[model samples]
Target chain A: MANKADTIISTLITRSRKPLLDEWLARQATMAGSGAIAADGDVKEYCTRFLAELDTGLAAGEVGDIRGAGWSGMRELLEEVSRSRAGKGFTPSETASFVFSLKAPLFALVQREAGDNAARLADELQSATTLLDTLGLYTVEVFQKAREEVIARQQEEMLELSTPVVRLWEGIVAVPLIGTLDSNRTQVVMENLLQEIVSAGAQIAIIDITGVPTVDTLVAQHLLKTVSAARLMGADCIISGIRPQIAQTIVHLGVDLSVTSKASMSGALELALKRIGKAVVERKARPAAEVS
Target chain B: MDQIPILMVGDCLLVSIQVDMHDQLALALQDSLMTKIVETGARGVMLDISSLQFVDSFIGRLLNNIASMARVLDAATVVVGMQPAVAITLVELGLTLSGIRTALNVDKGLALIRRIIDGEEQAFDRREG
Candidate 1:
């Protein structure tokens, strides 16, 4: 015998598909407060597509077990909707409500169809609630995963964009660090600085931490490691941009940088040039009458 | 069984590590370098390690041993041409390589040794005068 709830739900969905779609969309708009962000025409199309997929899914087999092969079409459609809305900045509740709000209209149809029969009405309502709840939670799961992926990608891009090694002179390179120095970012900074040192054959490297907001013991340790590495590569490292505040923090934290430091980039550059046996001298001015 | 070659340049000994060195090879190089320093009465030693892409703690310690041995034999040692990656790896491995002089390349290393020897000669000449 065909499951009574599945039979009734399949028939209701086929016969009252349009009314069910209209009612569900209206209810979702009010509940989700999504009218400002989502267009009415787009909402209608989504509701229509979801209802068609539901009808096919319910006709395929038992409605209670959503994980079964019968519900694949509906599951795929919900995943698509959840992923797109996640990228669009939709709140978890608003996205899940797209599946949850269908409950009211669907349960009402179940009640009207199974009138004067308490056991039949209860069984149908239980099945409908279970299937819809499963789909709703699945949407949330997919949405959370999608959002995390986006965050991870953006963090990687930020790491790459932040750590840039620049060639300041013929045999000098500089890495101007900005923002927080975490272990992952430190790896990128070390790799880039070392690679540039090899390619440029630089003898001096200036690490300017002027944009670094604060320096703690860990940050100091990372700086020391980079300096030591550069020294090993046969290049002397000069740490510039030692603002008074950072210097105080380093002293207070009892972290020894053990490398040459300067007050600013220009100071460090001057030192780098001197170490490489080069000096930047001011050009002598010509007499104004010589041109005439 | 391959031995690292140590060439004599003027009064200084030059050792360029061109192949990957195992523990035995490093020890052999150190032994050969010490004998060369004594045999030639060398005033300085320049070790060019640009071709060495990696150095574990064993190799790092060996380099330190060579420097210390050269110092005991009255020869100053200047390590030259270390690749950046190798340096970073050494530092990461917690070997600071303190008290060792280093130069950017072979020419700079030669000049440094020359300056050190010249300064010693001038000091000796002042005492004699």
Candidate 2:
């Protein structure tokens, strides 16, 4: 409480700026060499800029908390590093090493500054280690959160890309589900299928689940719900692409799929056409083909 | 105090519900539709509920009652033009409305009713059994 801004870190950084940059860059060059970020990155520029901002933050005498008013610039710098590194596919360690690598050069400076005074040496080293550890851990937390946001965005895009309701015929529609069917996805699928049925006036719908990897009881229940909703809107639903395995699973689960189901999409289509009083017949064979 | 107009097209009575349906409106519709079916000797009823964006369990039961009363009056009721959202809501509420016939639109609804009336297509059987 009596001392303010009389810190060893400000003195240590102000004097040993060049040595700190050189050692930090050297350590960074060997960090998981040549996997994600390139060796000739602008790490030099960041080292210099971070040193300058950090020197100011330390001089302001609020080293106990990096989130304090004194360290706004340093915090912003770490956030920038996190965002850019996350976009470039940097792993958690690689991103966090940007801060952690500074510790070695800093401790060495503390070792030199404290000289023969053993008590001062321990005190400065303790403060330095605590500050660097806090900052390094903060970097890792930011990087991890950034990566999670990226994953969440990709998941949303995949959901949008996956569900597409196709009009197979004048009065028929098909939805080919291709991934794991969760409750969220089932809601999207059911809404899309029912909307298509109404807009296209599709009397029959063929739900081709050939690409769906598994059909557990929950998925089967979702399917039944969609069928019931479609029927309420006066559109018949025909589930096709019931591979032998899925069929076995459905029967084993004792899920009574009372609606009409066919083994393949074409079979479903054929039934839908027949229900609508239409049939696809082969054209008359060409005379040349007949001769062959 | 608004009444849903029931337009009689030939032998089919077309009730296109273009307004919001409350409990009072539903009961009024049942009363008026029952009276009209008895008077006109209509063989079929088509309910166009495309404009209905909301419904509760009571309205669901009202639809079932309307269909049952029409069948007793010797008329087959085919509900048509039900919005997709309304259909999903009804299904989510666990009401299948299995007692009534359903079609895509007015043209198809009329065709289904005619087929049932002429003994071509079997009307959906709703009974205690």
Candidate 3:
């Protein structure tokens, strides 16, 4: 009786073998490809073949009914494959390699569809490409753009300082400012002026603001710093050029300019000469103080 | 008095900026002038404010900021052309700029700068020659 019970159990387990084997094979394929199988039309064909094999096996008492499930069974198999692959880990190098390898395929796709839509595609791909680079999955061209941006910013910064200075006369130095003045550039201007005044041993420095478009609080602060620095070097600095609009704005901002010695470019020139104990003798002019 | 024109004479940046006594053109001038200074890399700055009927705190502060910035950038800043009335106004306004260097006018500013730079160059020449 014990032998007969054992035999019955063995027979029941045997009957399930074919179905189990079929399920196992489907799982293996899914594990190998991840969800990549769904991207291919060939996967459907493969599934059909698998089902046919399953059916033949079951009919022959070797897993026959499994194949009869057809498309539904195949779809289920794909879903399982996708899920299995989703959990896999990729090393950094592997991920990088994968992204790099995609360059050829991406380029191919672009070339094929690039006839009328290249520009749009390029723009769309730009951000994605940058994102990938930032993630360390960089393509060569994307890396190049990042490099270019860094270089440009460096160049702009370099321009702010180390601008060459030229001396006009004894005890007087003039700095002609050009272009726009932002907060950062203003800081640069302050530093350069102070250093030059000290190093060149200037006694009077002229700052011409004729090219300046406008002045704000920050800019005003910059001008003040220059004056203080010059004074520190025992130099008298002149600030010139007062545009009509700018003067009105200064009053509006409620800032004062009491300690700064300013003049028109002409007056500043005269002051420079006077400071050096020299006075210009005009042919038919009034007193030195009555020019205006 | 009219708006001053900032011009580059040799190493001396001649700035004849017309600071409107009652306007905000000074701020505008700062913006444009800074852009040029950064671009052209002028050695020194000269400001002529004869056009200004009054000098206020705002202009004074900007002048100071420009000076400090110029020093950091290895440039010199100078203010030229101050009208007597404007100077008095600036004093009354209690606006005191710390680092801004001033001269009388463009010529004076230029001459001072030229002399200083020449002395340095002569020293450099003595060293290098």
Is model 2 an incorrect, acceptable, medium or high docking prediction?
medium
| lDDT of each residue in A1-292, candidate 2, tens digit only | 2124666778878887888888888777776744454543766777788899889888888877888888999988888888888777777788778888888878888787778998878877788777888888888888988989989999888787789999988999999988788888888788888998988999999999999888889889889888988887888999999888888999999998998999889999999999999999998878996778
List where candidate 1 sits over 4 angstroms from the true fold: A1-80, A101-117, A177-191, A210-213, A290-292, B1-54, B69-89, B99-129
Model 1 chain A, poorest ten-residue lDDT window? A32-41
In candidate 3, how many Å is residue A133 off? 9.0
Give residue A165's error in model 3 in angstroms.
3.3
| Candidate 3 TM-score to native | 0.36
Count backbone clashes in candidate 1.
Answer: 0
True contacts kept of each: 0.67, 0.86, 0.02
Tell me the deviation in Å of residue A26 in model 3.
36
Give lDDT: candidate 2, residue A18: 86
Local distance difference test scores for all models = 0.85, 0.85, 0.55
Q: How much RMSD separates candidate 1 from the native structure?
A: 5.7
List candidate 2 stretches off by more than 4 Å: A1-6, A10-77, A108-117, A149-166, A175-192, A209-214, A241-252, A282-292, B1-59, B69-90, B104-129
lDDT per residue as tens, model 2, B1-129:
999999999998999888877788889999999999999999899998878886578978988999998999989999888888888788889898988889889888998888888773333343322
- Checking candidate 1 for backbone clashes, the offending pairs are none
- What is candidate 1's local distance difference test score? 0.85
lDDT of 1 by residue, A1-292 (tens): 2344356778899999988988887787777466643553466777888888888778777676778787788888888888888887888888888889999998898789999998878877777788788889999998999999999999989888889999999999999999877777877898889778878878899999999888878778878988887777677889999889999999999887678999999999999999989999998888889757
How much is the lDDT of residue A280 in candidate 2? 96
